[model samples]
Target: MSKINHFKGVLFDLDGTLLDTIGDITYAINSALIVVGAEPITTSQCKGLVGRGLKNALKGALELKNREVTPSQLEELVPQMLGSYHRHPYRHTHPYEGVEALLDDLAKEGIALGVLSNKADSLVQPIIRGVLPTHSFVFIRGDKEGWPSKPEPDGVYAFSEAVGVPVDQLLLVGDSEVDYYTAEAAQVDVAIATWGFRSRERLLEAGCRNLYSSVEELRKEVFPWL
Candidate 1:
């Protein structure tokens, strides 16, 4: 095992890291976009924009195919989008294959487990509970009103503090630029989850050094102590 994997805790980004939530996100986005006379986005298109939180994700999806939604239109549509997601967050959402086993192995290693996402705080727990009921995480937080999301270090700092783990001793595992920047800002090591939303090329372009291609690979590298 690499020395960097010897972490006190492992913090994950929910959308791309822990769960394959792109389908539901795409569906909700399209459902809401149609309400404003906009075109729908594909699941692939939604993957690239999944982790940036509500507004950014919506904006990216709206503009994906040269389709545009003004700030005013987006603001007006936010509530409908939120409501759609809240009502059907788990319609097509599920953990990446072997994620449950990977989480179990990490638990056996006696390391703290946490989830920090740009998804709404209220939505995070319910989605987790529905999709990953067996895994026990110590910290599951999403974008609370006052806290900045990932790529800003605020969420990472909050996770470290909440879990009582030193920033350097935590492994931030994710699959997007936001996740990469969060680790960079907080001065922590990162493991790129290849099975998540974005492309591996994008992660590599962003200078990701640790790439976990599968759950078995993740178990070997990140929780080998088990």
Candidate 2:
């Protein structure tokens, strides 16, 4: 266990780290694109496009194929896409192995837990309820008006404030460069999940402080301080 995993509370990054919702998101995005008379993208393509908010995700998906849609076109299609996802955020989504157990163990120890994601609020709750019902997270926040998402410190800072813990007392767990940047911007410790979107090399390049290859590893490393 690395010394960095020790912390009082944890703020988790949702999309690629805690839950694998990329398949469902990809389906919705492709459907929206088709409705807009644009081409569709594959699940693999969608994985690379995630982590940022939905707007950026869709923009990246379109850009990957050299397809460009106006901001108005994207805005018009977003609600439909999100509505589709809201209807079935977990049909093809599943928790990474050991995540449920990890959450359970952490909660048992009275460690604070919260979810911070670029995913919209309406969609994040249902997915969590569907996939991790027993995980007693203290708060689950999503992208909102005026609050900058990950890669910016706003969400993490807000999370720490909500948890009644100092920013330095929290551990940010995630799987992307954006996550690392969020932790850095918040001046908190970070634990990168190997099972998510970005590669370990990419995470290191982004200045990740620690890495966990599995949920069990995360539990072992993080629970000691509880």
On lDDT, the candidate that comes out on top is 1
What's model 2's lDDT at 24?
89
Residue runs of model 2 more than 4 Å from their true location after superposition: 1-6, 224-226
Model 1 CA deviation exceeding 4 Å by range: none
lDDT of each residue in 44-163, candidate 1, tens digit only: 878877777887888887777566767788888888889999999899988888888778877887888999999899889899999999889998989888988888998778878888
Model 1 residue 194 distance off true place after TM-score fit, in angstroms: 1.4
Best by TM-score: 1
TM-score of 1: 0.93
Candidate models: Cα lDDT each: 0.83, 0.81
lDDT of the structure predicted as candidate 1: 0.83
Per-residue lDDT of 71-115 in model 2, one digit per residue for the tens? 887788788788888777889999888777777777776778999
RMSD of each: 1.7, 2.1
In angstroms, the error of model 2 at 216 is 2.6
